[model samples]
Target: MRTDSGLRLEADPRPPRALPPVPSAIQGDTPLSRPKKKKPRTKNTLGSASSEGLAQAPVHRPSEGSELPAKEPAEHPEEAPIQRRQRKTRLPLELETSFTQKKASNSSLLRNENGIHVEPPEEAVTQKPRRKTKKTQPAEIQYANELGVEDEDIITDEQSSPEQQSIFTAPTGISQPVGKVFVEKSRRFQAADRSELIKTTENAEVFVDVKLSWTTRDVALTVHRAFRMIGLFSHGFLAGCAVWNIVFIYVLAGDQLSNLSNLLQQYKTLAYPFQSLLYLLLALSTVSTFDRIDFAKTSVAIRNFLALDPTALASFLYFTALTLSLSQQMTSDRIHLYTPSSVNGSLWAAGVEEQVLQPWIVVNLVVALLVGLSWLFLSYWPGMDLSEELMFSSDVEEYPEKDKGLKASS
Candidate 1:
């Protein structure tokens, strides 16, 4: 290492290794030369470069034993300004890699900024069979894609990544969404506490049916020509009672008010108690044994239950009718008012007062009986009761292809 002189000097072992070239986008900005950043991430993550002034990053891929990195809780500190600009444009980073990474198709012999050869991650991370999801909606797919490294935090916005964003976008438009331009929120992820774990249901190891004797859903279909009889039977019976009282007591019960009143009173004594008792029991059985008692981690059973279609329209209709009927003071007074006026074992005949109750009694019966039928107005009801599906201990999570086929067949 002599420099045009007789005297010669040996070169230093560490001759200030040359720094990597900066992207034109970041050439003017000062770079962050923090010593802590010089350390490579323990797993798969972006690498950083040394800059002069502002912490302008220049792209560098980590070495083979490189660590993994997270996204957006903090920006990729190692991403070059050009990459950032490209990323900010809503263009996918993975898409860019897909195009430029063709050479790695044959081998993992890819060179980084330092001329060090490293294994390409496209095969392992990017190119893979896409898993089928229950929901294939674009927004839902985007949300699932975010479940990669930073999956814990569901960005309430549509996000695209190599994991999602379609297997291949048209070579033109490049109109893929990348957590950039936000779409108006449609209320997908509403987590009060993102850190909170979902409340999982206590499922039995074996598939057991508590109400095996009550009736299988098939019987309901045979009788009512409806698969789910829980709703049909419960509501129809009540509606029938209302229609019966309306026709006979309200319309046919003419001048014989006293006779009609007594008949109605006798009929109601048995019917009223039965209806009330059935309502309670019906609610209980449907809630307990109707479903598998299953719920999703993100799904709130009650919220999803009510939000199926016209939110609250179904509930409002049935409940409103129920409230009106119950509030009539008729159900409460039916016992006292309809009771015979007797004293000292002597009865006085009431030809006028008792005979003129056709209007009052008719109105009372209509409201009380029709209360059960109100549920019929509810339409487009969704399967809110996930518990309907029976789960077994033998059926494990991440069901294998065979298990799925068996379940589907069953």
Candidate 2:
């Protein structure tokens, strides 16, 4: 381009210098270059000025990869006390950072007194072991032969061998029959001992069946004794009366005695048998009263005499005889008292007075008295001593002490 001075201002005509050749190593290593140096971190001073500044200033977040400086002690001694008071009053930046980190780390981050970093305590975790179970075996069929027979019978045909049979039959010491026999003998011995104990108890004298020992013989003997006493008294009296009657008849009318005798003879056929029976009964009663008769034999005699009551029979015969004699004396004109005077004759005819007692009447009165006495004795008569007769032994025990006392007394 031309200037006003008319000189040609030619552009520098030097060819663009050729650029130098780049090194390949430097181009290849460009991506692997070192990182840029970071600026030095600012430290948080724990002083009253910094604390006051931090309280007034808004909180600011640090960029990534930036480190906060450690806290430095106060420089001035006079400010140290005020710095500590401020530190106590206001929260520190490091403490706030640590708390934020703890929250972000889910409480895993911890801080110590000098703001040292700490890790959370480790927890032990246990895992349970799996259990193993054993498989169940199949059920077996039990047959009746398997229940009662030997083990040899339990095996299958394939297992039935001579060795198995020998193993089962080897024990010869245990004998079931011998053991059963011993048990049976033991039971029998125990039973015999028990029976002996029972027998001993039975043989011990106890007075239960006391009345069973009372035999009819004892009752018969007692009755016989009572009757014998009565008969002895009554017979002697009656015999005396009969003798007196015979004498009186002889004195009153000796000629009439034959008639009276004939009259007695007429009734003798009937009277003699009854009279003999009465005498035989009286004799038997007397014999029984005196003799020690066997009670067993007495029971047999009582059974035989069950058909007749001896006391009633004897009384009936005596009364009948008396009645016949009284009738004969009253009806017959032969048996009477003899009166020679007319007054006596009139007295006899009037039947108002009696000089002598009638023999028949005397006999009847004696018999009546005997019957009355016999009845009275029977009414008061004590029966058999059943307690004594039946008792096998006294209720009192025969102790050795009693016997010793008796011997000492003797």
Candidate 3:
């Protein structure tokens, strides 16, 4: 194809071009086309040579559609040479055997038959024995025994024969009652004959022939004296009152006893003293007989004394007077004449007087009755004899004498 320009643009001549044929040698010498050189084989280099051979060998790659079996690497021959070298440099046989034996023994010790580990028991070490010493007795008991300061002679069972041992034997006095019976019968007859004659005696005295120490009898005698004084005072006071009443009858126109109120007013002061004396007498009488009285013989006399004694009669008289005074004070208007100042002071004072007088009467009466009952009970109540309780003797041998005296008295 030409353009429209006049110049004739003839078509340029074309030439066919071709590349020279590649030289066969040069083509064969290319990396992809050349054949590899085979390594030289020798005993010392065989291992390395084989390894190179294996690396140069064709690898079988699996296609996308098929799976191929995995290949394992072959063992290298160099391993044997390395093992031989290590063996040549290892420790001696004896050292190796010792190490192995130690390891085996340790394992055996650590693991039991059941595979459980446990601690070993502690070893016990023996020690030398020690000597013992004797113990001494207390000094106080030893001294007392050596000095013969003990209260009674301690006769051992080996020293005293059966006949000589009085520990379990009954007293001789208690065993023989014929003499005691005769004495009691004779005493009863004498008492009967002398009863009327002795009734008028001021003191009702009983004599005991037992040999008692002064120390044992002191308290009893003191109490007896006190009771005697109290009885004397009581009798004296009664006598004085009687004399006063007579004197008053002659002096005051004898009008004091003409009325109940007058008599109570005059005798109120004496009532308390009489009651006190009665109580004191009862106490003294009870205490005096505590150890001296033989209950079996004196039970009846003691009962009579408590029931019909002069002290009891006086207590009853005073109690009656107090009761009469209280009744008159409550019912009679003449009571104000006795203590007008107190009556006019306050209503409370009047009430207090009554309250005080009532309790006084009740207390005195109750106390008197309790004292009498206590004495009676102590004298006659079975198994309640106070003689044994009140005795102050410490010697066991003296008890036989006391028993004899008690038997004679009974």
Candidate 4:
């Protein structure tokens, strides 16, 4: 186009070409610098030249509708399909075979994580070879993993005989099936069974049922044996006390049997001596029986023993006091018999007079006897069982009907 200026000047007539469409990613009109081409590697001239040409092609270029070059995709058609065929075939034959084999193996197992058997498609087995294929290739060896078998535990029944793979021999305590039988007979043997074993072991670790081995009678016998040792010492002390009491009574009687009953009565104050023996027996029996009991229950028993009902103790005390009172009265009566006014004064002059010495000696003898008897009984008495009801259960509290209703309302 000519410019209006007749100086023969051609007008700079070209309008600004519409800018090429810039991708939103590229900012402003400034043209983006292209990446520099890498220098061709000098080492291995042929490989460098080929690589250079490939590298020089535009990178990050948008894909066009152009078709990729056609080429042979894989060397083996029997295995995984060539990359080219994989895109077109929705389901590969090798995968279908693996799925079928897994389903067959899983069906025979007695238990599974999913709990139910899912039958496989018939096409899987029909299309694949039935005979076991020798795992010559790396891909074939990994077929088990692809078939839902864990990598850590991919045992093949074909690899080892049933006897060689047996885990348990005696099967002594196991209530479950024999290991060898399960492996040989069960269709599910090859699949993962660790989940079941894991659950069982976890339960065992937390809770175990301890058989009630010793019956109540057996426990009682054990208690008796243990208390016997304590009884020996207590009984001996009681005997010694009895002997001492007898000797004191004889001497207190002043060689006269006439006032013996009275002398025994006077020694009533000595009754409390038997209490020591009773307490000792009680202590020994409790220690023996309680030691064998569960540690958690021991405290309850001890509290019960310590907090013995006052009424029980009072009843025994009343009887003891009565006996002492009677003995004391008898001694007083005997002393009266030997008083200067009674019959024995005339015969008593020579030996400090039996009357004078008798009462004193009898009292000491009674005291010893009571003390010894008390100790003996104490050491042999069995203690109470306070925690028998408390330890009846060890489970968590169950929600009562009322509580359940309240929860529902909430």
Please report the candidate that would top TM-score against the real structure: 1
- How much is 339 displaced in model 2, in angstroms? 31
**Candidate 4 lDDT (Cα, 0 to 1):** 0.34
What TM-score, over all chains together, does every model reach? Answer: 0.27, 0.21, 0.22, 0.23
In order of lDDT, best first, we have: 4, 1, 3, 2
Candidate 3 lDDT tens digits, 1-410? 11111011000110000011223222222212211211121112122323332332221111100221111111323433332222111111111122222243444322322234342322000000000000122223222222221111111222223443355543222111111111136446322222333332313222222334344567775665565455444433433443443344234223432343333456456554544444444433434343224333466436635776433334334434334334434323332234533556533343344444344434434444444444344334323323443343433456888899999999
Candidate 2 lDDT, tens digit per residue, 216-287? Answer: 656765675576566556544554544454454345433634343333324334333433443444344333
> Model 3, residue 5: what's the lDDT?
11
Clashing pairs in 2: 210-390
RMSD for each of the candidates: 21.5, 49.1, 52.2, 28.6
Q: Write the per-residue lDDT of candidate 4 for residues 1-410, one digit (tens) a residue.
A: 11111111111110011112212222111112111111121121122223332332222011110221112112222422222222112112222223323344444221222233332443232212211111122232233223332211222322222333236432212122222212223646553354454455555544543325656656765665556556445445545755665675576455555564455345434434443443454344334334323225646434543665332232233235235434555434444444333345442343443454455455545545544444444435434222232333232134466677889999
Question: Per-residue alpha-carbon lDDT of model 1 for 300-399, expressed as tens digits?
Answer: 4455446753323344334444554445444434543445544343232345335444455655565544343334433334443343333322233546
- Pick by lDDT: 3 or 4, better one: 4
Residue 106, candidate 1: C-alpha displacement in angstroms? 38
> Which TM-score value belongs to model 4?
0.23
* Window of ten residues with lowest summed lDDT in model 2: 125-134
